[model samples]
Target: MNDVYVVGVGMTPFGKHPDRSAADLAAEAILGALDDAGLRTVDIEAAWVGHVYQGMAMGQRGLGAAGISGLPITNVENACSSGSTAIYEAATALKAGAYDIVLALGVELLSTKFRGALAPDESDIEAQIGLTMPSVYAMRARRHMEQYGTTPRMLAAIASKNKFNASLNPLAQFKKPVTVDEVMAGRLIAEPLHLHECAPVSDGAAAVILVSGKKLSQLGSSRAIRLVASALRSGKLEVGLPDMTVEDLTWRTAEAAYQQAGLGPDDVQMAEVHDCFSIAEATRIEGLKLYPLGEYPARVERGEAGLGGRLPVNMSGGLLGKGHPLGATGVAQVIEIVKQLRGEAKDRQVPGAKVGLAHCRGGKARGVEGTACTVNILTI
Candidate 1:
């Protein structure tokens, strides 16, 4: 099998775009990535698109808008992990020698899709019980507090750090730095989680160009970021009473990714984790083994996870401040890491960074910890 590298990455500014169609957003992202790769429409061998609520032939519509057609375009919808899953499929094809150059695009125009809080599919018993995304995280926050003495202020600090990081990212949804006090005083979505602590409903798109080792050699581009590992796993069924604060699914997926990359969490210099909620950041870092269990909250308080700290997490403001555009989120996380590894993340750059990790967990279903979880390791 051959290695795969991300030769190009592009994304639209994440925010409410009531007038933009999903196809428009996707087409823009695709063109940007093609330009970034220094490639043209005719260079792509195949394509895969990740989307939900975009209706049938979403990939075809988006790619057609970009003037790309007649190529195999697989559509993926693994909830929020859809984007990363598309990347995984593209890499898989490259490794299998099915195609040398592939495009993985993720797009979602969520502003026009739904209003108010997002919930699990109605088929899910949990959704029937009034379980919303925020409420689920709120319950997890409560569990973390009970297990580790975490305070609401500590949770707010996570939001503050991410939002501050967002201020440096021109494309982020919320570019202004928010204060912990402001976060704490924000409207309550669920107990222990304020509106500021939750990821906003966003509309955006991101795309990446994946190439085989042979393709990379032919291109001879120094801008490529090696995709050292890509691991995806579904949440296991909960049995008996288990610790809700711990993320077994994330650990399993991350472990697989580390082994595949031949690098552990300690080797990662920066990370873009799934911080759909303030507390999710802490739990994800701990689960990824980037920090000791029950210690990330204090680590944030001491700025250990800040831009210039020991390990920078969510330098793109993450989902909390960067905005979570569902299908687009996972791909956007990889884009941020690629930028950071390439020394192009100007204001939020983690200096001397060599390795980065991107984690994305999405969706909620009945009797599962999560719907899908993905871990991708990238290196310069």
Candidate 2:
């Protein structure tokens, strides 16, 4: 297999834009990525797109708008991790030497229909039983509290910290800094989660270009960050795992990625994690084994996730600040990490960041794409 490297990355702000469709937003991201790569439309060889609930043929529609068509543009729907899954596909194809230049795009334009879209509507019993995303996450939060003594305040602190980070981001949906008290007082969306703790309905897209190390000459002597590892796994049953904590899928995938990279969490200088919600970030920090299990929430409360803190997480403000554009979020994270590696993030940059890690997962605590997840490590 060949080595893969990210050549360019780009993103659109994550938020509500009732006027925009998923296709147009995605095209803008593609253009931005292409421009960043200093390439033209014909430079891309293949592409993969990730999205969900955007209606049929959405991938083709979005790609066509980007001025690339008929190049094996496959659409992936892996729930919230949709964007990350797409990135893994692009990197895998490049690593396998099937393509030198592959583009991955993640886009979503959410409407009210997105709320109930997860139900088993004309599909399964879960949907018929009214199993919505919020409730599923709420259950996880509740369980975490029961088993680990996690609390609403801890969850709120996560939200508040992310919101504060979001304030540094110009594109985020909610830019104002929030406090734990405010999050606690916020409207309750489900059992233990206040509405503020929930990821709001957002629409946006992100794009990235992956090139084989052999193709680095195309960029003409610019310092290159190589893709050290990319691993993806779907969730499976694993008893005894506490709620919202590390899952077997991400753990296993990270193990493979770490093996491939010949590095561990300690090698990662910074991370662009999947913070679908505040608590999600806290749990993922443990799930990814970035820290000991159950310690991430407390660290965040101590201002450990800030820009210059121990691990400087979600520097692009993450999904919380960057806005969760569903399918596009994973790629956006990649974009931010690339900037970190290149020292181009300016104000939002992680200082002297050398090795970076990015992870994405979709859907529930378990099941299919919901359980599906990917972890990638990159370095210059």
Candidate 3:
């Protein structure tokens, strides 16, 4: 395997756009990324796409719409981590010396018809148990409260801060900021989680162009956000131990990435982690060793993880604030880091950002914490 660097990035405003199909939105993002790279779609050697809800061959339609040439294309799906899978695939391909320039993308246009998530399958144990993502996250929230005495007010504060941050992002889905009191009084969907505490179903797309170390010069305007390490792990029943879980998978993945990059949490200048829910953000921080178990909230309350904190996190508002377009989130993370490194993130830019770490996790796969996770560390 060889070095891979992200040289370009793009994204659409995350929100309801019932007028556009997933293909159209995805193509828009691809065009933006190509323009950002000062290249044409024809320059792409291969591509990987991730989406959880789109119908058959929709990825092909996106590529064709973007005027991309006949290249090997792989469509991927890994629930919420779908977008990250696209990034990992592109990096792996480039590292193998198979392709010098590759495109990694994720796009989704969620509407009210997102019933697939609600559909039940008799043979599926969780579906049989009626355990949707909201319910499962709610359970986790409950456990956090029962064990650590985490409060709803704290969760509300997290939402409020992220919302304020997202207000500066022109492409963010929600611009209206909220008060902690408002969040506390907001309509309750699941106990301990007001409407503001949960992520909204959003519609958007994000894309990025990656190149091998040798092909970095192919890019015109943008410089390299060198992809230092890419690591992915899936949970297996055999790995189950008392402390073993999907959260543990994040730690393992980050460890591998840390070893590969020769960096640690202390070295990371910024991060855009998977924050599908409030508790998830806290737990993941601990799992990644940014803090200890059950210490994230205290760290968070001290403003240690905010925009000007020791290690600023989720400058893109994360999924909770910017809206989770599921498939697009993973690649969007890379896109945001590219902007931060390039000094192009006008408002959300992290001062003196040079090293960044990011991740995306999704669904209940064969794991204790459920689903799979993909992590990457980058430097410029």
Candidate 4:
């Protein structure tokens, strides 16, 4: 099997873009990736696009706007994990030797589609029972506090950290860091979770170009990063009540990624995990084994996850600070990790990053831990 490499990555500024369409955002991101890779659209043999609420044939429409046609284009939707799922598919094709060069793009114009806290599909019993996205994380936050002695202030600190990181990220939604007091002052969305602790509704796009090892050698692309592993998993059905503080889905997906990469969590120097909520970041890092269970909050307070700390996490601002454009999010996470690995992240760069992880978990169902989870490992 041929190893896949990430040759180029691009993402649009994540925030409200009421003037733009999803297809337009995708075209911009795709062209940017092409330019970054020093390749033309003609070099791409196939494409995959991920989006939700963008209607049918989104990939074709987006690619058409970019003046790219007459190629195999697939549209994927797996809730918020849609973008990462597209990346997974592209890597699979590269490894299968079916495509030498492929494009994976994720875009969402969420500003026009919805507002306020997003809920699961209405058909789901959970949604019917008034289980909203914020409420889910809030419940988990409470559980973490109960089980780990984490404080409301600790969770507020998490938001403050990510917002600070966002201030350094030019493409992030929130460019100004908020204090823990400011975060706590925001209107309460759920018990113990204020509005600032949640991810904002955003519109954006992200794209990545993947190539086979042979193609990498042919191009002599010194900037390319090895895509060591791309693992994806759907949440398992729960047979009994499970612990809410921990993420079994994240652990399972990371385990698969670790096995494929032949490296443990300790090998990773930095990460961009799904930080859709302040508490979500802690559960995810612990699930990835980057920090001990019930200890990430303390680690955060110690500056261990800061940019210059032992292992920086969410340097691109993550979902909370960077904005959550649903389908565009997972791909954006990879874009950040790739930039960091290449030492291209200007203000938020980790000094000596070599290995990075990008994890994305999305969706909620009645009896499952999560809807879908994806873990991708990249190395220089």
Candidate 5:
């Protein structure tokens, strides 16, 4: 099988884009990625677009807006993992030689879709029981506090850290850093989760150009970042209640990615995790084995997960500070990794970052750990 490499990455500034349609945002990102790759519309061999709550034919509409037509276009939706799943499919196709060059775009216009906390489908048992994303995460935060003695202050610190990182990210939604105390004082969304600790309703898009090893050699692109691994897994039905503090889906998916890359957590220099909520960062990093279970709060306290720390995480500000435009989220995480690997993340750059991991977990279903989870590893 051929290896896959990312030749270019692009993203719209993640925030409220009331004036933009999803197609327009996607077109902007697509154009930016094409320009970054030093390629044109005609060079793309195939495409996949990810979205949710946007009617139909999102892939065709977005690509057509970018002047791409007469090529295969697939639309994917796996909740928040939708965009990352598109990348996984594109990479798999490249490895199988089904396509030499592929484009993966993730776009969402949530500002016009929903007003408040996002929830699972109405048919979901959890949703029927009045469980919104915030409440679910709040329950997890409560569990962590009960099980690990994780304090509310620590959770607030995570939000502060991510927002501070966002302050350095020009494209991030939350440009100003919030103090931990300020975070603690913000209006409560759920028990331990404050408004500042939750990901905002964002509207944006991100796109990436993937090329097979053969195509990369043909193009001789010096900016290429090798995609060493892309692993995706769906949540399994739980036979019994499981620990909310741990993420089995994330662990399983990340383990597959690590094996594929022939590397372990210790080798990961930095990461962009699905910090949909403040507690999510702790749970996900532990699930990926990037940090010891139940110790992440302390790690954050020591600044071990900050930009200059031992293992910087969410340098893009993550879903929390960067904004969570579901479909755009996963691809945006990969873009951040690509930037850090290419030495192009500027102010939020992790120094000498050679290997990076991007984790995205999405959706909740009845009697399942999670609906979908994806782990992607990249190397410079």
Candidate 6:
């Protein structure tokens, strides 16, 4: 087995891209990564592309637009974890000596796909009952409040923090920071959840070029970031009414990743967890054990999770401020971690970041805790 390293990372601005085709966005990201890696298309041994609503042959179409073809290209779709799952597949192949150099890309043209709040598949019972993502998270928020004494203001504070971080990010969708009061005053989406707390619909793409240890030695690039672990897990069926305030799936996935990386939550210097909603961030970090259960809200309020604090989370502005383009999200998270590790994140950079984790959880099904979850650990 070969050790895998990411040589380059790239992401398009995450926001409305109604004028761009999915292939175009993917190609831009792919080329940007190639340029960053100082490599050419011919250097890629194979490619994997993750997307949800881009239909069939997305891998072929995206790579074709990037002037890459005649190689094995696998298309992946695992809901919101689609992009991260693509990275997981690529890493597995590299570790198994299947490829010396591979490209993993995630793209979505969500602006032209849907409008308003997103829901589960219509066939799902929850979707049929008109339960949306906002409503589901709202219920979790309410429960956390009841159980942990969290407040609506605390959730707004989370939003304010991410948006402020986004202001420092050039590619973030929402550049201007909003106050906690602004977040609180925003139109209510569901009970206890305002529009500002929800991740907006976005269209974007991101890409990373990974190489084996031998290939890295051949390239002699000093910018390579080692990928220590890439772990994925699917949610299990609920036996009974489970605790909504906790995320068993996230904990299990992070445990697997930490084990594979030979590290623990204490070693993680920074993180980019799935923040589809304000409440999601609080629950995810808790599940990852980055913060104690029922203590993240207070920690966040104390500036512990912000940049230059104890442990910065979502320095890329997260989905709340960075925009959630479904397929692109997971890959984008990895890109942020890569940048922070490389000391290239400028204003939002976490000081002396070494070990960073990226988490992505997606989808919902009837009677299941979650659909798909992925955690990737990287180190400089």
Query: Between which residue pairs do clashes occur in model 3?
Result: 246-369, 365-371
Note the Cα lDDT for every prediction shown.
0.93, 0.79, 0.80, 0.92, 0.94, 0.94
Which portions of model 6 show Cα errors greater than 4 Å? none
TM-score of each: 0.99, 0.93, 0.94, 0.99, 0.99, 0.99
lDDT of 1 by residue, 1-380 (tens): 88999998889999999998899999899999999999999899999899877889899999999999999999999998999999988988998899999999999998877887889998888889899999999999999999999999999999999999999999999979999999999999999999999999999999999999999999998999999999999999899998999999999999999999999988999999999999999999999999888999988988898988999999999999999999899999999999998999998888889999999998999889898999999998
Better of 2 and 5 by lDDT: 5
lDDT of 2 by residue, 1-380 (tens): 89888877878888887788788998898998888888887888888888877878777888799888878887888877788888888888888889998899998988544652243234545656677666766777776787778888988888887777778777677878888899999888776878777777788988988888788876663855788998888877655643454456678888998999999989988888887767778767787788887777778778888788999888777776667877888888777788889988876778888999998876753333256788889899
Put down candidate 4 lDDT per residue, 1-380, tens digits, no spaces: 89999998888899999999888999999999999999998899999898887999999988888889999999999988999999999999999999999999999998887978889889998889799999999999999999999998888888899999999999999989999899988999988999889999999999999999999999999889999999999999888778898799999999999999999988999999999999999999999999888999887877888878988889888998999998899999999988998999998889888999999989998888899999999999
- For residues 40-65, write the lDDT of model 6, one tens digit per residue: 99999988899999999988988899
Worst 10 residues of 5 by lDDT: 238-247
RMSD of model 2 against the true structure: 2.3
Poorly placed runs, candidate 4 (over 4 Å): none
Backbone clashes, candidate 2: 8
Candidate 6 has an lDDT of 0.94
TM-score of 2: 0.93
Estimate candidate 3's RMSD in Å: 2.2
- Model with the higher lDDT, candidate 3 or 6: 6
User: Candidate 3 or 4, higher TM-score?
Assistant: 4
The sequence of per-residue lDDT tens digits that candidate 5 reaches over residues 1-380 is 89999998989999999988899999999999999999999999999899987879998999999999999999999999999999999999999999999999999999987898889899998799899999989999999999999999999999999999999999999989999999999999989899998999999999999999999999999999999999999999988668889899999999999999999999999999999999999999999998888999878978999988989989899999999999999999999999999999998888899999999998888888789999999998
Error of 3 at 350 (Å): 1.4
Candidate that beats the other on TM-score, 2 or 3, i.e. the better one: 3
Runs with alpha carbons beyond 4 Å of true place in candidate 5: none
